[model samples]
Target: MAITDEFLPVPVPESLSATYLVPTARGSGAKPAEAVAALGERLSDPVGDLALQMIDSPLMTVDTRPVSQFPELPPDLLAAFGATPGQLEQLRTANELVVVQAGYRPGWPPVHEWSARAVAAAIAQSLDGDLIDVFSLQFLDPATALRSLPDNDGRLRLVDWILVPYSPTDTGLWFTTKGLRRFGLLELQAQEVPAQFTRAWGAIMTGAARRLLRIWTESLTEQDVPAFVQLPIETTVTGHDIAVAYGSPERHDSAGSAGLRLDLDPATDPDADSFLTLLPPAGQAAAPAEYFAQICTRLFGSGQPEIRYTRPSDAMARAVETARRSLRSARDRFLIGGLPPGVQLVVKYGLATDEGQEFVWASVTSWSNPGRIVATSTSDAASDPTVRVGTPVVVETADVVDWALLDGRGVIEGGWTQAVLDERL
Candidate 1:
């Protein structure tokens, strides 16, 4: 689909209209002053020099007032545009212009319709011919983030990034480098009407085009607009809570062994889909599929279980609670198990110190009796690793956050599991 389908165009005002105008210097092939002079006897108002002021980058001020807005214009601007009286009149009512607040100023200064034409001319003059010919421009909302695609070797590459942050404000324009064959230049091909104009405007504002727009605004329009910065917003599914629930043997006896169900909630669980299904805790059952099917019958009974997942922000709070409970009694250790080997963890010191969450990696040094769970900076022999020899609980109810598991090959995967030294021994 065309990028235009993704955004809403600014609504046109009723009192006056704005449209992009091109001068002869920009290759419009018509002169505005000569056109006005040609209508000498027909001229309703005194001929005035056209003045164009920037209301903002990309959108220039135009004076549609039948009476001229400018007392004078630079010889360069006047010399640039040539248009017929009819063409000049058509430019006045064109609906292609976007309204903008004056930069570093308060009120909307009087914009010259003729000046809008001058600005377009200047842009056509400054930009590369290929850029002007190949791309069509339209304004868009600020983009917030970029997602990188992987390279040919399976390594993630920061290629042509796209930001789909779901912002709704109308901010700036984009010139598309794609769809030339299929859609053609958007601005030219769009029907010269308000609806089509708006549609065309919307199509070119993809995140991929924001940088291009910024460059055009700064270089051609002579405006030092602020650069776009991305705000990191965590939208991943990270909430989850784990618990062990037993099923009634008589109720689930037809097709199962020990009917133990592992329930994971959203606020505490990083992996929701698998845990939300209330599967038998990973590694606990001989056959997970059969165990969950039968145990789910007894645990959830016959209806689907309504589970509320927690947001990522809830991590600190949940982790705090688990830490408090674990520190209160040496015998009760918050248990977080089911983590594969080579996982990494970060201990977030809430309200304890100025230091933020500290990242640590987990490596299982031994899988035999009394196996050691080490969380540290690196597994290299030189660096000391923290031996996780804390209290252990029977069920998975420990609060943990800012934690991620890396596979043996060092690729980050998901959550980690905590096993007690006593139980494993």
Candidate 2:
């Protein structure tokens, strides 16, 4: 895509016509001489001098009439014959030209025709350019403004220029122009025509180039397809909860177990062909297993689960021994649970401010039984006393075991049975 495609060009009309009225000379009688003097000042230059001499020669001022007709003059020559609203305003504001009230037919063409010639003469005297390479003059409608039209000469063209006149009252007149084309007018128009024609034509051209560059960049990006891989996993577990009571001879005599149900949806576990159907053919070269391994490594680790079991009686004996040793270590070190992995236990001691200052003691209390474990130093004892007592631990055994021990009040202070925590411990 090109920037040119995004914006349209400005339209130029084939033919245009308008009128202007010449102001009468003031009674002070210095108007003509002053105009001639201003012309002389500019005539010091060769082109301006030639234009002035032509204007002053007898052939030029033939009728000095307020209205006259001239035939088929080149458009550029119009600048030499008349002044635009911009030029007149400059002169008027600067006091170089005076405005005198004049009468005209509401739709008279002759008045405008004569005014155009006068405008050309003024511009010729003021500008340094040759008369063949300047703008044409025209009257704006509503009869309150003036406009400039550039000639066909590539050298004199003005690009993207528009002038609009604003007058709140009929007594005053104003005019503005889009300015001269420093760059080629047609070249600029070929670019983007500005939303507001009064902007510099060169700026519009730069904007068009930038837009084209962006379009080309985006098109290239869209053509280059991206690649991806797919790996799927589907798993489910179902089970019913049951309550198991201990201290029952029969229950204690047999291993405990639970019931579970499972249903795996086939749609969720589609094979390679089904998976490939959703991906681009270009991405199918890799083996499904290779993609699956990648997905596993990305999601879960490469390590496989290891399962082992000891006889129920032996497992129970081992657990009791481990708990007893842990309790003894806690008393000997005044530290809790052999500093269980990732568990931070901090103890700070200071002298008591009052009577019981001789003794320093610490203890690990369990919720399963408020007194399940206790350790303390008695004043007369040579060492701390330690005790390990058991209470019913709420053990949830399934694919995993979640064990929680609570006090009579049913509040859990702390407990850990997660597989990760067990491994560390």
Candidate 3:
């Protein structure tokens, strides 16, 4: 997305208030005086410009500075720092700026403690805001980061919103009304692009900040909490005699073993009368009844869940046929498995196309002994010319159960089948 188009200017509210927290620390090789002097030099010009832009009013100069030698600072600085409410109102009416800075001893119980407390206090006092004490030594602790003031009757007051800086070092932001809550964090870094992209780059930064803020706030009310559960998939064949199998073991002794059976209706919803018409003609040649009996025995032997197939309703059957026809021409496919027997499927076909031709392909996968068939070749294969057969299509192992299935010719299909052979075999 184009960041320039995404981030347009919005009106700045009249009562725009933000607190700036700056930390000062003595470096390993630097003296305190030297550090302070360096900071003074670095900030002098910017501070002067800020004061000019922010502080403009007529007021008293209460310089608590020693009256012994230097009575007070320059008149302008004194006026900027000591402006009164009436002066402030007059300045505001005239659209003039005003700001104040008060200095105090940078004392502390300990050096490190002092540094943190001083920074927090300065920022809080600067805005006349409250100080939130963070117990965790971590850089930014959300629990104690900042809390809004209590409302009228001493109830914890929640603000309409808050602006927060995104930190890459920690997990997103965290907060608490009843207790602590964590919000995800985001990081954005610009790459070295051409000069023409400067506006686009700035827009990207602006949008990123806005999005992060929204996500942080919305997380407080989100309902979709994370939980793990197994989801099931069903497979069936139509218009032809077919066999089905199940390979996985059952979770309980009473549970039937895994095996496949011919399913007339694969769908959960079936049209009763229309489905009967699609069934195989009575007495027609079909996989031996014994085949299904054996499947049941094997499934029950392992104490696996029994796989069931029922006739499908005419509506569902027709829908499946329509979908199959539509997908017949497309080949490339991708599949993703959930939980730990992480299974993945990828398929590519060999057929000539106007665009290009692809022949070689490879895939690596892992699955449980009785894992469900998540994908197939006919559905996934891509049409390309460099087709080859027996391209190590399926690789299965016993010890680790990690396998790979690859095919050059566009053709692959198998799901819920009996174990082909034992690991030793």
Candidate 4:
């Protein structure tokens, strides 16, 4: 779909706050200080597809590689840009650009006018390099990304969301969230674009930062967010309360409220702390108590103990954070991640009866779901975690297996772990 006015940077009303972003770049050999100088030059003439009234400080780093590093970039993709591989490669290495950020003013032009292609071309021309398509990072807008997720039928499964951490060294797009990297939903960079496609380059760049902010907020507010379990209590506050405070105007709670402010929540209360200063996920009104009970049971075991919200023990907090980060790290592995085949789905399920209740971690081998998955056990302890019961059981989202304890050695082992389940019990 083409990026229209809906995709453009929203006009900032004086009463409300808004910031505009543009991906700025400089040649590889150019000094980092030159980006700052170029910012001044752009402001002086204001001559480009995007005319700037105000600009913020650039996020300068020498770590970024150019678009040429993209793996297996097909010949057709290159031809569409009216460039050759060798030509593009020369330009890519020559122009190691710094993505400059800026605070846009009121009535800034819609981003389509200053497309990614245009910005990349302008930067290349200035650096005396070939004009080729340049790729940058962008977070999938939640409103757009969330629509792609299928509605769940009371079973936890993979949700389509992209939580990216910008890394200058990496050229591949990553979905830094739960589930394995192969199941990642937002691999926009890898998609095969049609030859005739006219990319809405400027619009995507303009909306990227805003979308990123939204994704971070959505990740934080996700019900049963595993990250909250790991936050370290800080004597002083440092980060923004991205949760609750993010979203379109309709999603906002109030304009000026103490609870709504960015810094106050975590500053005053340790329970509200997010490692990055984000607010813990607010309780979801739509989520049924049964679901919450299930999640609590899965994390801490049966009886569904009330997890203390305020001043949780350090172990509890750390576990939550570890779970959240491990999920994100699994996403980061996308550079080498995918479900190659023969991967088993391990799940922990609760069986309750009048006598009492017990939880068992089981494995489903060669699992498939046409409508619903039928389960069978291979009974191999090494290939799968050993289960006590002989009967097979079905579960949703094979990738939802606990990852909280999958750190250090877990990364080296290169697979999912029931470690969280093992530790919680």
TM-score of each: 0.15, 0.19, 0.18, 0.23
* Regions of model 3 farther than 4 Å from truth: 1-9, 21-38, 48-425
Q: lDDT by residue for model 1 over 1-425, one digit each (tens)?
A: 12242221211112222344222212333333343334333212211222222432434342222213323223332222222344343334333322111112111222332233233333323321110110112211111000111212322111122211111111111112332111111111111111101222222123113322222223223233222211111111100100101112233223322222212122345542111112233455333323322333333242111111222344435544554444323211113334332132222111111343232222222222222222221211111222111111111113222233333233353222221111233
Superposition TM-score, candidate 1 onto the true structure: 0.15
- Of 3 and 4, which scores higher on lDDT? 4
| Highest-scoring model, lDDT | 4
Query: Which order, best to worst by TM-score?
Result: 4, 2, 3, 1
Please, what is the whole-model Cα lDDT of each candidate in the order they appear? 0.24, 0.24, 0.24, 0.27
Across residues 1-100, which tens digit of lDDT does each residue of candidate 4 receive? 2333222111112211212111124534433233324534332232321322222133211234554443434445454434455654553344243232
- Please tell me which model should have the higher TM-score, number 2 or number 3: 2
Kindly provide the TM-score of model 3 when superposed on the true structure, using C-alpha atoms: 0.18
* Top candidate, metric TM-score: 4
Considering lDDT, which of the candidate structures 2 and 4 is the better prediction for this target? 4
